[model samples]
Target: MTITSVIDPAIIQAYRETHFCVEGDAPLTLRIGEKNETLSALHKASGATSSAFVTAWNPYSRRCDDETNADLQKKLIDELTTRSLCFVNGVGRHPASDWAEPSLLVLRISLEAAKELGNRYEQNAIVWCGADAVPELVLLR
Candidate 1:
């Protein structure tokens, strides 16, 4: 298994400086594919809890192998609607590698935000937060 680590200190620093705000409601661009709608889709899907490029795979795609991106996306949607947890996808993957690129996706929300999603979804959702001001995952959560 390979463990891939990706950290763009510049991006993080920029986000910190700007308080993680996007301009004029413009969607954040992700690095995996050129498509710009992931951020906006995730934002609307996740109720704007947070936005970031995450590492997820679509099983039907040759790149994903076993998991369909649709499945992954659905899982995230459920997580967001039920629990209001944010979904971030961006990291790239290589064959035989364990980790994907664009590793860190932030979910910044008040406890009230969490509560607003209600209990059923909240009960089904869980988030793994990072300790070092950033977090990494082996799979695309």
Candidate 2:
């Protein structure tokens, strides 16, 4: 059975338009369903067959203050740190929107774990990729 997302179409569109960027060392940008050579190389170099792009901002697109978002994101980092997961700091930004959020490229994370993290943070969706390095949107709403 297929589950329909309750998330708004506009929000979903914004997600599609936004750039999922991984920062540090070699910066990389991920576009939904697009194969990224740099990302594939990163996966091969790190021996990580999968990666999840997640953020803890604007739960369900309800726009929270910067401070609240920052604190929530810090908590997310703490959770990843506790798990000893390898993650890199990143940000998601849309070309037409000024709003941007702190994000992370979590290496070697399972799809289930990524879904759990997205739900735990009350996000509408996340970007996940496998060894193919093609990002796919996972809606949680």
Q: Where is model 1 more than 4 Å wrong at Cα?
A: 1-24, 30-51, 58-62, 65-67, 86-106, 109-141
Q: Candidate 2 lDDT, tens digit per residue, 1-141?
A: 765789888888889888998998999999998999999999998999999999998888898998999999999999999999999999999988787888999999999999999999999999999989999998888
State the RMSD for candidate 1.
11.8
Which candidate wins on TM-score?
2
Evaluate model 2: give its TM-score: 0.96
Worst 10 residues of 1 by lDDT: 132-141
Give one digit per residue, the lDDT tens place, for model 1 in 1-141: 643324344432322222111222344533222334544454555455343322234321225534455565556455664764543433333433353422224355444443333232222111222222222121211
After TM-score superposition, the amount by which residue 50's alpha carbon in candidate 1 deviates from its true location, in angstroms, is 7.4
Best by lDDT: 2
Q: What is the alpha-carbon lDDT of model 1 when measured against the actual structure?
A: 0.35
> How accurate locally is residue 30 in candidate 2, as Cα lDDT from 0 to 100?
93
TM-score per candidate, chains pooled: 0.29, 0.96
Q: What local distance difference test score does each model get? A: 0.35, 0.93
